[model samples]
Target: MTPRATTLADVDRGALREEAERALRALVGREDAVLREDQWVAVEALVADRRRALVVQRTGWGKSAVYFVATALLRAGAGGGEPSGPTVIVSPLLALMRNQVAAAARAGIRAETINSANVTEWDAVHERVAAGEVDVLLVSPERLNNPSFRDTVLPRLAADAGLVVIDEAHCISDWGHDFRPDYRRIRTLLADLPAGIPVLATTATANARVTGDVAEQLAVRGAPVDGTDGATASALEDVLVLRGPLDRESLHLTVARLPDTSAQLAWLAHNLPRIDGSGIVYCLTVAAAQQVTEHLRASGLDVRAYTGQTDPTEREAAEADLLANRVKALVATSALGMGFDKGDLAFVVHLGAPASPIAYYQQVGRAGRATDHAEVVLLPGREDRAIWDYFASMAFPPAQEVRATLAALEAHGTLSTAALETHVSLRRNRLELMLKVLDVDGAVRRVTGGWQSTGEPWEYDAERYERVAAARAAEQESMVEYVRGETCRMAFLRRALDDPELTGPDGAAWRCGRCDVCGGASAGVAPDEAEVEAARERLAVPGVEVEPRKMWPSGMAALGVELSGRIAPGVQASSGRAVARLDGIGWGGLLRDLFAAPGGGGADLGPDGDPGPRDEGLPVPLRRPVVEVLDAWHPEPAPAGVVLVESATRPTLVRHLAEGVARHLGVPVVGVVRPVDGVPPGRHDVNSAQRLAGVARRLELDLSPAAAAGLPGRAVLLVDDRTDSGWTLTVAARLLREAGAEAVHPFVLAVG
Candidate 1:
């Protein structure tokens, strides 16, 4: 590495340490604020020695202080001649960037961020960085890959950068929980960086494997980081690993094994107040987060819902409320993880366990950062594994699909994601994810329009993908083992994360003496009977508004379907209703069980050679709820008949539901909207465009005189087993309305 900053030997020791202490006082605004030994060591290494370092300390350990202080001294040319360029930091979340920006200002450092949320400020921010008015510039991982930024701004920044920082560095390692494909671009950035530019990588949750992986990734200085000829690179050329113990003395950890989702809800409602401060209640899915938020609010607790699906504005508002202690808690999913800091948060409760231990540690690390005492509780449910599997299904696609995607991009120089859908049947998210992975793999490149192949040979690494999958499965098992073990809770976590200091020089294992196993905590008591009953009542209430699809998916005609644009008001179905969400707290469990599809579960034809088998109508547990739904719903003109959306996979259930609803309405069972003979039965879980094209091609009303005569002329309730993307219900309703029915209203068992 080229040397641009001051050398360690030439600087006077006394003056340099005093200047560092002076900067620390200004950064923290404390008269007696002095840097800890390790913090001082890191600063000296970066500013004086000019070397790359990786610090893996627990939360609230002054890691951010190390970098900010370094930035201040380096910008002032502390006992040196030339001032360094702005320090570019690659942060993972907008919340983290906000916190960093504010913290930087407290230290008298001029900081600005460029992200999707602040697009209007990009030019101004860039100008400030160029004019040396800004000391620190923060950018998200995604912003690094933008064609404009990569081609224009990045080259200049790399040529003159004085320091680089990667926050939440654990995300850059695939072995770590919460691996992001975009973070892989950091390797390229490091390769392009000019020599003598000191770098720093920090995280609070990386294990031994993840730490090594991140160190290796950060060593790419225009060549392979891992030396294979005979010798490996030294610390001066790569990274200096500074790892400390991973334990929180303030956290009072406990595991409460609840019987079901309702019981877990009851426990939160009963105990949140007793914990005595504002905090967070975490759920596994968006549906659960919404359900818990609604139930808690109704129980007279002030709270809000925060999830991935929540609006960006609302997320900001919720974060502000939580920080200000305006609400008791924010019932949220993992979307609220990492860099959301509150000094005195009283507790962190999980309604469902995360898939891995590192993830759990990262989340709970948010709380008790500035406080000496806080509660950390886990309420594990049987449905946790199912939720994990659901998320795990979003991994890299098969080799065939990857090759097909590459071929399509090669054939067409530039294609938008929507136009690319014309060639591949994958959903938007999965397709976008695959494209990103391929981009990093050197087989494709994103451009002005969309994406283009790089004309590079690409081979799918199936074995490596398998290894990653296996590692994930093992982490899940470790999470399960954690809840069931009787050993030291803190030690178990440390070992899982491979904390180096866990087994100290004394050859003894470390224990927190504060967790449930250490007999320093207590939280196993059940909730009150009254609270449980109230939660049950709330769960038992059935109804979720299923909004109909307003516009058609783009590029449907490319897939041999003619539908496009908005559906006319005359043919569109009115709003609809469902019993509950498949991942909800009340009827959610029952519906999941009712619709569990195992090996052709109701998919094939019955033994009698009939298109749809005859079976018992509506399960016993669901009959009264269906009646309750009808009683609560007052559709216009009432229903003249019930028309079944032919479910080739669940025809028996669909037929039974149609017959039951028709009987209750005192009307006839209208003719079924059968699938066309040649089309394949499509899945309900794919993306909007793909699902829409499939439904349009598979479903239609018979035009034969005999079949047309059975159609209903007035309003009808269009019935189906479930609604996923809502495309099935929308397309089927349009077909029925155009055939003969005057109006359509959709009803379904569940909305997933």
Candidate 2:
């Protein structure tokens, strides 16, 4: 039986809106479910008017509902005979995609997602989408640029897609707090889209500037002229923007000024149970998240660590644990930030401040979403700025490096990322990010085999990049101000996001009357003395395993280095230990300060002609950790001597550290590997291949009679100030093994 259908000309506007409301009610499984006026306006614009729109609303504002409702109404042929094509949503995170799929299922809308994790199912998914069996298709921005998808799938999808949705739209703007280079590919998708196909871009954290940028991209050029207008006109200025106040009334913001990392961990251990329900404890780095997770677990609290390093299955498990309230918290990095849905999350605590106020706002927005009151606390650490500086250093490689990458691609015709790495000095992550940016700018194209330059006249745009960098630095300063400012905490955040509602009729910032400063809430609440002491002990206990590099980096020969394949098992350095990662909690701050540049008051090398003085020794706190590591190592054939990797930059510190370890282990001082003939000082900034080549050419073992006679047939403790690529340790260990040492156990003050 053919279903009754009405054409667009015969459609009743009032009946269409009523049908949309019914869809919303079915979506939420509640008869009382009704769309907000703004949400309805967005839905009407998309389904009724077939116009593009941008929604910049706060978290929990039902931005998803706007798209889902529109998808249902359009797919059901609101005023037509046949079902419309599927809605393609460009989402960012897998967790978010999963949530959307489930939500759509509840609304009787069939949804499917294509992402890296489900590569094996892509063919089936594509078939379903092609056959119109799928009503909604979710894909990550990165997937859009995939060779197969871009060449074979995207054309059909874009041509027939009923609506194109870009979630986390802030990522499209370079000025956004979490700008993703791949998100820029959406502009290409938008441009290729057929006219009259409405597009919806949504984000919870875009400020006015980001809103304008996103809206401009959504605008359609040379759009078909409507008959009513009787003239052809572009749709560039027709983007409907719906922005709401960036305020979370349920959140009670506060800052707890702890003396150190130990105190902060102690406070969390003491206060987590007191919070209303399960939540997240955010850390600025993966190492810190692991550290916090371990400490909390030791305190008998249920917690898990979530970071980029975690396995896919484990991350999913962790998310499930949080959603089911099976765990107290998930100590996580920014990997868990966007689109995680937990309506009843009651609290959010930060071990360290994020680099920008915008990022902080988005992270904290996850809590107090469904509850009347949720605690949001910030434990600002002194080391936050240094971490920020480290990340900032990786932003859009210098013009020279970018040009080198482009030139390499042009010269080679097609080169993979690994092949390109040998031609450029940027590391893997930075190189990939740079390539994505260039790809979006039309300067290069990624093919099946690799990337190829398009010969487009691309400018480095140094001035624009510099402006962005300056803006980032200013944001970091604003974050610091937010932490230490005397103004109302919520008000300060709202003002930072440029929330119009923050200003009253008189044009003055309005106090939220909910934060610590405005509400007179005490920030000293903490765990009991016993728990604090336990947490202190757990944090103070330091030692991180430094896994030895077993495999040589590929493409060494291409870089003119004659090494390849896995390092010989017998020559590999045994598993190593460090006091801590330079970015971790506990002793990380001290190590960071210790290794700081000379201009920052850190130790400096002696005058050029010498190996530097050895009077300066290890600091007292570091001394105990080194001894603890040595005692815990307990090598099978106990070490017989200690050998130091001479540091051109901090000779005195490395010498003392090696000597202290030897004394504690009662092992004799073997000899040091000194820099040979004037091979310029090794650079710590280059790639593994370059660093290995430099170290190989520069460092040589001191083959003195004492060293040769004392080293054979016994394990030796190889000590260094730090280990980055482990190439230095690999070379040193191989040399020692060849010199008759049975094994070398590497130790370091810190590991990158």
Candidate 3:
């Protein structure tokens, strides 16, 4: 019986046929003539639906071909409509961008990447984009964030943007296997644009979170499929997450710790067949990559190092060599795997444990690109755990420290980084990271001056940070447990690690079954178990309590205050935006200048309205003089002089007098208050009083006391380091009057 396919009138069969033919022709021209049946069906469905689609196929599933071929047809006017200006592809890596550009050119499509690693001239590219001369624009997230690019080119493209394709769309989610912070902002960028541009988010792998986040980021509802008028995923096979036996062939899984590069090189030399293919050797740091590259070169292996600092041209050349089979191995630090697709890798050696299992999976996934038997060698040493911990530590600040910082800001209103150090004692790097987290979490808001508690002062919740930290910790522990599980390693892995792809009943056939502990072989598991337990115990010691410490400049204690208590300075306090304010003292003008002046020897009063400056620079606070009173047995010059004192105490008053005598000679000063608790008072005499009173006028010294005993023996004097406030002198004078001292006068070192 012949089956007749029902063709709906609304479905543009002519357009679909034209587009399909155009794409087929382009593919044939590019020497990629073979198209799987599913690929054809997917293309037909997408053309009929008139919606962007996601291709969720595995690494080698011809995913890129689906999009490129479809693009070619659309650009060739096969869909019975004029194509948009260009197809905008937002790739995650520079190498991927380059490859796609080259692929497009080969297929007779005008495509170019906008990313410039090192270019003195970007004007031509920007102008081309603005003029809509290019068929496609490939850019990185960072490049997209450029205001110039966004303002100059993106708006023009938005109007007729054919499709916005995100290659590594899993990066949209933090829970994605390969997450990047910049990737999270793409949704916002697109949402702000003018046009209702169709977005095509594609990735080789996606967990539930990644899938959901990608859909959400692209503004898709329900499944990211055709019916939603958004995207339809090609018929992708269920992800084959293979978990195999811990055997000699599965050299990567057998290690408790990744071995050094030297050991890995030797292992590779011993086991790997030189089949004119290249491999990647991943390390935790650039130094490790360099070290491996040096040794590998010494061993006559074609090797190179790729790091963050690697030159772009050199990096491209090295990758070209690897792809061309001119190099056997490339030692790198997370740089080689994501963007470059060298189809014939024989091995991937991880020199240390990645910070997370997903990272490990991503790194290992670089190998076995072909259907051939390839190995992912994890040469973990005893130090690998520590290295992983170090990585995590760098990624996330101590949650407790973050919590403490939040609490301090809430309670104190605002804090400079210096004051924050005292409250939440953390190293400079850790503190910066914590502050950033706090800013991101919105528990604290970083204004120009410092971090202000956004919520209430008592809000010290680090629940989310702690939860993430704990989840990551559990994940790491699970990996360690996998390494030491006593059961059949393959079974343990498949059951525990959620690897569903190893379908055969006898998993041995899928991977190495002759592991040391498997097949009646001894792996010395007991010793390893002990070592694991010891390591766990060591890390289990409750992390040190995170608390903020109040720190102050040195020599502050000499002024009768603790080093930690005096003007907590770094940037500026959150509250009180003023040059300086002191009342009742004649030196108010001077005090203002002392505190408000900007240059050295003056406090940074900060702009009047803006919150004080942030403590990013860790400025030094100016030290002001202290007021010390001395006992001269001076009698009252005025019948009702105010008494001014540091602490309203006899000793401080006496010290103030001695210090003021030479500085404030002939200042008419009187102390009213006497010592409490029967403390000895300053000597009372007419000559001392007259001399103090006369000099007090020049220095503006004041004294006041409510009673004879409370009076500073009419011998009170006012002195302060800087005159940020006239209040010190004024306050001292009032106190002297209350202490029964006569005319109160004031004296200060310098006025604001």
Candidate 4:
């Protein structure tokens, strides 16, 4: 791929470019009513800066104009056309990219967009990128996550890129409503770029903490312009917000009880008149959604349902209908959030409680985008609240319970909740609840037996008095903080939420003054200093202190042990030191500190680095004297095979030895173990005999019936992962001789 620089003459810049510049300069120099004074100031801030600093302006504050001015400066021939790297803009949403691209095309700028939607042929895209035909490549983070895309396109962009723009930059923070795991990796992506690459992060909503987080995530210095909250409030005036009368509306909450979809269908039929505009009925499950769609269609209400079960094509069609006003209503599961832009929605009805508060807010926000008044109806039931409560539990776990669970695990090697509750003198149900919370934090993953730590857990003591008090306070405050105000309810909401829209007297008023509690079309009366101070004092109570913990894995001892001897077996041994070396000198001190129980015996000198307790524990098999050469061995074929048997008291031992030799030589090994005194010859325990035979089958060796054998001192090796004593190896080798071999040798992985 070759890089090409685009000349000013290459794009449509005849008279349109001049007109755009004129229009832009007129607004820049003088305050125009259409362009707010603050908006112009924001544009100047971006244009005036030599280095990039983020403009954390509110939504609908003419943020696009700031970029326009910057683009014009970069291209106005003040600095000659970019020699290499094109100015790159990294947008979070494809729609935002499309919007920005359309706006730029109108202004006569030579801009282009390359994202997953386009650029199907990656190699061709790279070629064009290197050629430098594109002035701006609008991309989503998802496209960048592709390894091929990163390896190919990013490098070329990095080489000549001047500016990188990130829209909705709040998503980069954990606190963002939508937290993408991969989004966290973008910090590294930005940092690893060429030194001169400057990042621009813009978001509609950001609190102080989120602003700081965005700056750190992007690795940039930020310059925040004040009054953004007011700007957003002004934009909301143009948006209609209708609040339904609490008692007058014909709204009765109905829940889909009884896995029966009949009740829900009947309710939708009864409420057809209320759902006048394009409506949405949210379902909790895909099966429910499907049933509702089927039953609703039978009753004749242009309904379509979407869930994860729907194919991509079906989902896209459903979304297109909703957006194009073709479908009357959409009955959907929670999979309908991202990139949904249906603005003129009249009603949104919740069939079930949503997964989380954030989800509920986002879904509700989708409606009444253009209208002055929008209605949202929530239907609550035991099932709905149960699902909601489950999520809430995961989101905000009881700190006392989490701390107790973690402490129990730390004290005991590993504790089951059943056992831990007994040990802690608590109920099993309560303990289970706490463990579930830890599970949600990604601190642990549930296993069949118990939980395994996935990452470091947040250190929290749910039982501390301070923590309990804080939780109680936060719970109470969420319910009682907002009341009727003289001004519009939206203003009170902005004040309560501390959104970027609570600034200035003009911005303090809602567009529609009839918002329920605030029935007046003006700003509410300002709170006196005394009331304000009291509110502040109440809010100042500190939140609970969070402590982090890491889940640790145990159970290494139960994986079975390895045995080895001085002699080399058929297998090769590397030059690394044995486990015993790590144990004798370095391990004891380490184990004492880590586990608080010191092993003082020879077993403590067992395998190097092995964490086995040294006192009164059964000696691990790996510490035995004989190095058992047990491997997935395949023996070679020979004219005569050797019989190998130690003095095997058990036929199982004899069969094991036979199988090992059989595999090594790729021939059947005959077993010949002498019967115990006065024992019936062929009446061995059939169950145990059958089990030994099964071992032979697994090793790909054929076991022979008892046969007379004789052979000694030729050359052969016995292998096993474990060896307790020398007697088994001795009898096994004797049996190998009785069958017909020249020699028998014994080996094991370890000697204890």
* Winning candidate number (TM-score): 1
What is the C-alpha lDDT profile of model 4 across 1-752, one tens digit per residue? 34333223433333433433454654345433243454444333333322334555433345566565555555453233443345677665544565577666766555666654343334554567667565566776755545555676677676567566666666676555444444554554565555444446665444455556666555422222662222233322321111111111211222222222343445565564455578687787664565466456546677787765453334555666776777777888766644355557766767665643334444555566556555655553346545544444443445565666666666664555556665454455455545654554446545544554555757664454355345434433332222212444344333432455445785555343444443322222233445444434422321110001011111111222122121222222111111121122232233223223353422223335545443332123432211221232222322244343322222343355446445655654544334444332222212222322222222211235433322332334443322322233433443443434444544332222
Q: Evaluate model 1: give its lDDT.
A: 0.80
Instruction: Return whichever of 3 and 4 wins on TM-score.
Output: 3
Candidate 2 lDDT (Cα, 0 to 1): 0.82
lDDT tens digits, residue span 1-752, model 3: 12212122365765676556566567547444666655665455434443444544445555566667666655654445445446777787767777787777776777766654433235666677667677777878656545566566666665566566778777776555456655655655555433333456666556444555566556532343354433234312211111122122332334423233344445444433443356887888765675556555545666777765454444666677777877787789987657566556766767766655555655665665653545555566566678767756665555577778877887898776757888866875577656654554446655545668778343445585466567667667766765564555444444332343544575434533543335533222222334334434432321111011112222222334332222222211111111122321223344444434433232322332334422221112211222111221232342222233433212342344334443444443333222244332222222222222222332322322334555544433343333332223433344444444434434333322
Error of 1 at 190 (Å): 0.5
Best candidate per lDDT, number?
A: 2
Pick out the ten consecutive residues of candidate 4 with the lowest summed lDDT: 544-553
Q: How does candidate 4 fare on TM-score?
A: 0.45
TM-score of each: 0.74, 0.73, 0.54, 0.45
lDDT scores in order: 0.80, 0.82, 0.50, 0.45
Winner on lDDT between 1 and 4 is 1
Give the Å error, residue 467, model 3.
3.6
Candidate 3: clashing residue pairs, number: 104
Q: Give the C-alpha lDDT of model 3.
A: 0.50
Comparing 1 and 3 on TM-score, the stronger one: 1
Q: Give the candidates in order of TM-score, highest first.
A: 1, 2, 3, 4
CA deviation > 4 Å runs, candidate 2: 1-10, 220-234, 504-509, 524-536, 545-752
